[model samples]
Target: MVAITEMTNWAVDLIDVRKTYGKAIQALRGVNIQVGRGEIFGLLGPNGAGKSTLVKIMMTVVRPTQALGTILGRPLGHRGKLAATGYLPENHSFPGYLTGAKLLDYYAALSKVPRSVRGPRAGELLERLGLSRWGSTRIDKYSKGMLQRLGIAQALMNEPELVVLDEPTDGLDPVGRRDVRNLLLDLKQRGNTVFLNSHLLSELEMVCDRVSILVNGLVARQGTLSELTERTVEYEITCVSDVASLAGKLLRLGATVAGPVVTLPGHDIAKVNEAVDCLRSANVAIHAITPKRVGLEDILVEAMGGQDAKPSATPPTSPPAARPAGPHGDS
Candidate 1:
């Protein structure tokens, strides 16, 4: 039996979900993920990490070897439930012969959108997506960015409660990306759930309420952005004069000297003062001192077992105050 959590309206609730391809290519290995209602959740990983497979399973495009969960509070693969869900797959293809407006109308019809509402909704979405002038133009002539925006519009054509996008911003420039980000926030404000799969960590960091980093078909880490990132805080101090010579003295003050930059634990204000005092005593030129926050990318790289992660001077503490009470998360 699936465990019922406090989040009764979970957008996604899966337990020990597993998928395998052929006999040896295991795409997912009993993974667990829960996305809350109306949340902008992100899934990130390098290529071949089963991110796409996960999405496909959710969309019922791929049948999992084993899955025990509910989507939108309904049994997985319930066709009727799909009307309330929207999906924008990676590299989406639209009919080249149809005009942008007709394209949306066609999809709306497929979703059984009311004929009366389809026309106005299509126009509204085109205007909202900055494609109002191109509505009459054939999709074949639309640029890659335009096509991407249209893909989002088509996904929204049915006013779905849950929107799943795989690399939604794959072809957009900076401005286009910003527009999509703003649009995502707007959707969140409207109380729609968004499940995003993207390789762009920075973009996810900017918009996601929570994220999961999947590696080798397993979820390495998953939690709220702040919960995953705020592990250790360090204060950075830059000194140009004889930093190498003062390394020993700085170490004595609970500071680590990395070239001319000295990092002191953020919790220790006394060490910061002591570092300054020592620098002043040695006639050192202090350039800057700032808190060095742990970013999401840093944590992800560390989770991926990359070599760039810096070792903490202090021993690690208990894992972040138990990811905010809600549906179960990756342990």
Candidate 2:
């Protein structure tokens, strides 16, 4: 295990982390990620990727058998840091017989919250998370949204600096999803770092300060949403005049003209100017020029695969099917 003192930053850091299940089952391969304090970092990958494995390691639910990393400035699995870090697993299984208040109290104890402060804090969390009314209800009766809220409350019981959430809004309705998104924003405002492991590209795009995308157990890309997907679209110059002559000229200049629009692709200023010069010389009447911007999902698809990209027309209320299973399995 690496020493916690090795890292200068007190934020989360994973250096050359690797994990494997058996001789052939490799879960992570040289995975490295760094997140600054008070930043929302997103872990993105298709099903069967190593996002969950990384989160599990961070939470100490499963030890990294081969690789080493640290969380909240302490070596991962360091008991001292566990109290300062909170985790919400993707599939949580709390004692169904316990009331919401009791469940949170149990977690508070496990997190080593002072006995005197535990009860009051539990009540405060229940009220803040919109579960005060249901605090007396048994966990077995709680709806999915209610349970998710309680899960968040439990994770926040220790006033942790790093909150790791896996699919926080997986089964939520539109309103519920929005509420959880707002909760994440609230956490950010309070200067807490959220390490969110989710496949919901749109949601991550909305909230994440930075994102790391993994493929085949390796980090394919990592950066802020803007840096990863930033690109200038092909300038669309719509004209009203006949483009037959103009098309020929554009083709000679290595440009493509279709119908009334001439596509000046690439981000080369000189190339765009040359194409514009050719069009102007042909007496083409330019009616409109539009530069389309690519969305985060667009860039994700380009980097990962077309199959993982969510259809734009599909409503957010209905999430798309899981990404097709890769060789290792669905993440």
Candidate 3:
């Protein structure tokens, strides 16, 4: 294991990290990633693309069979640093016999929370996560959303500097998802580092400062959403005339058209002009043209070698809101 010097800066840094499972399953391939303190970083990828493996390596839940990395300025798997970090795995189950309060107490003790502060802290977190009424309920009785909240409460018991959450909103109803988003914002305001691994791209786009996308066991793309997608511009144009016939022509000319609109995919000025010329030549009078901001989901799909097709229905979109809504997330 290589030693880490100066633990005062980055909360997490990966230097050529690699992981392989069994004979041919290379879960991670020579990946290099870095996350600064107090930043919300998202690890995104398709199913089976190593997002979970990478997170497990970071939390020391599974040792990387190859390569190296550091967390909280200590080499990966360092026990001392692990104590200062909290982790919520994708599929977590607490002991069925224990009440929510007891489960938290047990984990807090393991986390070395002071004996005098554990009770109050547990109560505070229960209240904060909307679990106060169910403190005495056994884990077996808790609903999926409640269990998820309890999982988070347990992770925060020690007030760790780095919090890693995988699929944090899975199974959560709209309102429940909104709550988690709000909690993440509060954590950021308090200057804590949040590393999220999720398939929920909308949530990631709203909360993350930077994101890394993995493909075929390697980091295919990583950066701020704006940075990875900065060069791609999509515009939704609506015209009074039914221009559906022109879609095939626009696509052949390097544009994507869906239903009532045609979209130019890149930021090249010439391409935009070319589309305009094509439309004009076809005598298609434009009714409206609005820039369609690319999102984290859009970039991840494209990076994963997936096609950018128009969705079943045009998704209802509002300009980015200042704060993301809770579990019943405005759905």
lDDT per residue for candidate 1 within 174-245, as digits (tens), equals 999999999999999999999999998889988999998888889999999879876546666666544888
All candidates: TM-score: 0.85, 0.81, 0.81
What tens-digit string does per-residue lDDT give for candidate 2 at 1-331? 4554455564788877788887778888889899988999999888888899988988877767665557776777879789998899998988999999999889989999998888899899898878899999999999988899899889999999989999998778888788889989999999999999989888998899999988877888889876775565445555666687767778866668888767665555566667666766776655555443455666667667676443233122212333221111111
User: How far off is residue 56 in model 2, in Å?
Assistant: 0.4
Flag clash pairs in model 1: none
TM-score for candidate 2, please give it: 0.81
Per-prediction count of colliding residue pairs? 0, 4, 16
Q: Tell how far residue 120 is off in model 1, in angstroms.
A: 0.7
Comparing 1 and 3 on lDDT, the stronger one: 1
Work out how many backbone clashes candidate 1 has: 0
Look at candidate 3 and tell me the lDDT of residue 68: 62
User: Which is the leading candidate under lDDT?
Assistant: 1
Model 3 alpha-carbon miss at residue 158, Å: 0.5
Q: Candidate 1: deviation at residue 119, Å? A: 0.8
| C-alpha lDDT of all candidate models, in order | 0.83, 0.78, 0.79
Ranking by TM-score: 1, 3, 2
